[model samples]
Target: MDFIARATAIVGGTMVLLRRMSAPAAQAVGLTPTIPEAKKQGIMTLKMPTAKGWEPGHKPTAAQGLKVNAFASGLAHPRWIEVLPNGDVLVAEALQTERPPTSLMDRVMQATMKRAKAIGVSANRISLWRDPDGDGVAEVRKVFLEGQNQPFGMALVGDTFYVGNTDGIVAFPYEKGATKLTGPGRKLVDFKPGGHWTRSLIVSPDGTKIYAGVGSLSNIGDSGMEAEEGRAAIWELDLATEKARIFASGLRNAVGTAWEPVTGQLWTVVNERDGLGDETPPDYLTSVQDGGFYGWPYCYWGKTVDDRVEQDAELVARAITPDYALGGHTASLGLCWMPEGTLPGFGDGMVIGQHGSWNRSTLSGYKLIFVPFVDGRPSGAPRDILWGFLSEDEKVSYGRPVGVTIGPDGKSLLMADDVGDVIWRVTGA
Candidate 1:
């Protein structure tokens, strides 16, 4: 093996054998989950599984009484899915650009990423897929928007379609049932580019505003606080005034957002910081409160202080606890919640796409989970609705799911698998 790959494997394997020092992943989930004390790491665990695309006739295993099929395939790193009002699906084809190798750690991480098949040029385009006959497969495909800057999130408000690129949010004019966007979009807001690059966008229930989730530039302001301005928070943008302001702060990486139907509240799934063992702090799904702060660099889970960050007792004191713990390093990203009748047996819950883990000795995610809700709040144990993203040996991955959305028909769930470059459709049997 090459030096970097071998080195990472040796370290990761050693940690697996020494996992007694870490908390089990199952202990860090659900509404009243445990948060074990942090174990500071000089070098975080590097356990990225090799990406192996699925063979012909292979697909992710669905839950009992559910069927899985590829809605569309051969997509270039499909990362997010948005279903239009007319049953059209929009898939974002985005890839992360390799950062310049300026430091030894940077070079090492880049090499590890290459071995895991993660280093790729961004396609920077969105495509529209249509299954006109109610078939699972999309028979009609077209490039909806091209020449974007690693776009991820997409939203449609009235006649305007908005896309959240890595550097900004842009708006495009749209016609009903149109497949292509011919004109350039106007920039709504600019974002500072760094570590957490995906910007998740969601329109308000009343359609008066747009909320954009911007992640931190560094894990814990390591790139400096100035570099993190206008990041690690959700920004509310007024549609009428074209003005924006920070909606909530101290979110490390809120990658998905949805409006709760019963309460009309905004909820998001956030990926937390790393380097504190495998299960110190958990990723979470929480209701977004305006002007609220959840601790990031200073603390977590509402006052479990992080010593690595200089003491900020005041800010830590004000940190709000997240609504649900998604387990440490799960990389929970895509979130979609529907009313009780949408999917049978998975009633009134949020469907989350966990993108899996790279920093844990043993993987924690790599599956889709359903968090049942009681009166707009998460309750009960999360149900595993989809699995088989990783190979049986657990050393190779068939795919990693990102964005998920309920189909326009309201009976299907669409998932974007970046590693497999396919859009998966899940439906009741």
Candidate 2:
């Protein structure tokens, strides 16, 4: 190994030893997670499992009352999913765009991501999957759109279909039951792409607007707050006017978004800032308020300041506490509202597809989980819906779950497994 690689190895070894010496803190999960003191490190904990895909006939283990099957396979880094009115499923297949490492930390992160199958060339396309027979598996697959820049989110509003590319939102004309879109799309808005580039799109209940989740450009304004402008928050786009504005700010990386059926409020799952021990600031699920700030580099979990960033007393005072904590470094990326009876024994709740963690000694998430909600607020503890994506020893990952949605049938669940390159469907046993 080169000098830098050798140095990284030595540092990694020391971190592992230190982690073992200090026992892991109690898990921070649920509506009231015990936020621990911040323990900053020059080099954050880096323990990523090698990505070893599943063998033939292998699949994730579903919950006791549910059965799992590969709805579609052979995808190229499928990361997000959208279901059409005609019961066809649309999947966005893309990965992070490559940029040369500019620093030692960048090099280390790039190498680690490669080992975890998180780095790759973007497929830059969206494909359609149709299950006409209502059988668990999809028999028809077609490339619906292509030649796009790192697309992640798709929304069909009226006759216009919208795509959330890494750099902007693009819209194309569409027809009901149509299999492919051939027209060149028009750009609706621009976004600074690169760091934390996945833009998740969701349409409003009235179909008059769209919400896009844009993540931060750096871990904690390390590149200066100016570089993070128009990012790390959700943008509301007026469909009629084709203009967008920041809806909520101060979220480090809010990736998934959904609307609460009862309250008519917007909710999101946010990936918190890193380098603060293994369980200091937990990834969260919260009801997003219009014009509300949730504290990104300035503070966390309400007014608790992160001392690392230059103090912003005014902003910290206004930071809204999240509604629920989903565990630290869990990388929760996909969120969808699951109405009662959609899945067996799963009531009105949100299904989150945790992409899993790479910055902790022990892995946190690599499966699908459900957080029950009563009267539009999260209630009970989270329950595992599907697991076994990681090996028993936790050194190898067979898959990483990403975007999740209710399947076309309205009774099943569909999850995108990017590492496994398969769209899994979950149904009642």
Candidate 3:
């Protein structure tokens, strides 16, 4: 380790002494949860649990009657998952390459990213996994797509496939059962990059429109409003005209996008801003309305103003409150609706992948949670569906959950464990 790494490790150790909120209290900041007094730290707390590969014959513990099994293993940082109509599982073996640091905090963050095993040469490819025997294990795995940038979200509409790379959206010709793509893709739109880099893609129910979500460049317009142009919002693209427009705005980082089954309303799980104590502004899941602004720099949780940001009286008044809060700094990423009649007791709801947090002393998220819904609205508190990623000592992590989707059979829940490089399948035991 170099000087920056040593300094970061030492500071990380001292953050343990900082006052931290209990998990229950932090979660209470969820739907109508309390917002504690905010306190901006001199140096943002850094308490990420180091990654540790799973031991043999061990796996994550599933909820009550559900069972967890490895569908496929030995992947290269699988971060997103997509299942085809023919039951083939597609996993994006993607990771971010090393970015040059520009500031002291940037250097510290880079050192920590190395410890978390998140920085290196990205695989820049997607692989296809198949379990035709329905035996809960894959029998075939092959490279499906190659020569791509940092790809995350993927969608298939008819015979055309779309991928949301960190910088733009690309489309390729795809066949029903073919395992590989032989044609080069066309770019749809170029996204402005800043802080958050993940882009999630979702096609409209009618298959005519594509929704691409891009996150803000900075926590609160720190790079100036010019740097945030065409960012921190969801863009709707029309296939016929190849035209796009902003669908929603002021969402700091909308990484997960899904549509409610009954009402067809678009919903997203957003990662809120950091450095506001441990429970002031909670990350949330909200129904996206066209031309909506949810307040990123100026305020949060509806009308609660954040004095740290320059007051925007006009913008603050128009900020819409999110529908449901997930938790503070949970880093909620993947969002998918549960198919009805699957996973009894799981209820009609959406499963969220909380990739965990690094800005808190006690740590938050790092598991899969089920958020129940009724009549097109969030009904209750989130329930843990998969956990045990963090060790008992809270110093090591087996992996962190990211993308989530329903299997082609509509009975299994497919999850991506990026750090562990494994795809986990959850079914009713």
Candidate 4:
């Protein structure tokens, strides 16, 4: 290994030891998770499982009465999924753009991500999949759109397909039965890129507006809050006029978004800030209110002040507490609403794809989970819908789940496994 790689490996090993000696193995999770006192670390926990793609005949473990199969394989870092009106599936393949390490932490993160097989040239395209026979496996695959700027989220509203590129929301004229889009698209809104780069898009239920999740440019606004303007919030774009405004503010890295069917409220999964010990603040699933603030760079988990950042007593007081915690550093990034009986024993709830964590000592959220809901609020504890992403020893990862959506058949679940380069379909066994 090179000097930086060797240094990173040594540092990572030391952090693992320090973590074991300092804190308990259990991490806080669920709606009423125990929030431990923040234990700041000089180097912070940096334990990431080495990426090992699934072997032949290997697959994730599905919940009881359910089975999983590869809906499509041989993808290139597929991170997001969208189902079209014509029963077609669209998968967005992209990865983070490598930036030069500016600090020791940056160098460690870069090296660690490389070790985890996360650093690579983005595929920068969306592929279309078709399962005409309803056999779960997609026999037809085509490049629907190429040369996107690290696209993540996708939506189609009345012939205009919207894609949330890292730097902007782009719109293209999409026909109902067309297999590919060949026209140059127009930019709907520009977003500041880098830092947390995945832009998740969801259209309003009434189809009048589009909401885009824009994450912070830095953790805790370390680069100065001024650099974080127009970020760390969801932006709403009115289709009538080509204008956009911040819908909700202070979400650290609000990613996947979905609308609740019962109450028609917008819900999102947020990845909280790091370096605050194993369980100071938890990543959350919450109903996003318009003009509401949830607190970032000022407070977290409702008015629990994070003293590390510059204090804003007024903003902190107004900070709204998130509804549910998904565990600290779980990296909950994908959200979708599942109606009752979407899966055999699963009731109506939100399905979340936790991309898993690299910041905690013991890993958290390397699987797909379901949070049962009643009326419109989270009612019960989360249950694993699919797991076994990590090896028994937890040092090797076979796959990482990102985006999730109901399958075209409306009876199954489709999830994107980026590291494994496959789309998995889940249904009744």
Q: After superposition, how far is residue 72 of candidate 4 from its true place, in Å?
A: 0.7
- TM value for model 1: 0.97
Error of 2 at 395 (Å): 0.8
Give candidate 4's total backbone clashes. Answer: 0
Q: Can you write out model 3's per-residue Cα lDDT over 373-401, one digit (the tens) per residue?
A: 88988897789999998887777889899
Candidate 2, position 312, lDDT: 87
Tens-place lDDT digits, model 1, residues 89-137: 9999988789787777777788777777677688999999999888889
TM-scores, in order shown?
0.97, 0.98, 0.97, 0.98
Model 4 CA deviation exceeding 4 Å by range? 1-3
lDDT agreement with native, every candidate: 0.88, 0.91, 0.85, 0.91
Please give the ranking of all candidate structures by TM-score, highest first, separated by commas.
Answer: 4, 2, 1, 3
Candidate 4 — what's its lDDT? 0.91
Q: In candidate 4, where is summed lDDT lowest over 10 consecutive residues?
A: 1-10
Model 4 over residues 51-113: C-alpha lDDT tens digits? 899999999999899999999999999999999989999999999978888987788788778
Task: Please say which candidate is ahead in lDDT: 3 or 4.
Answer: 4
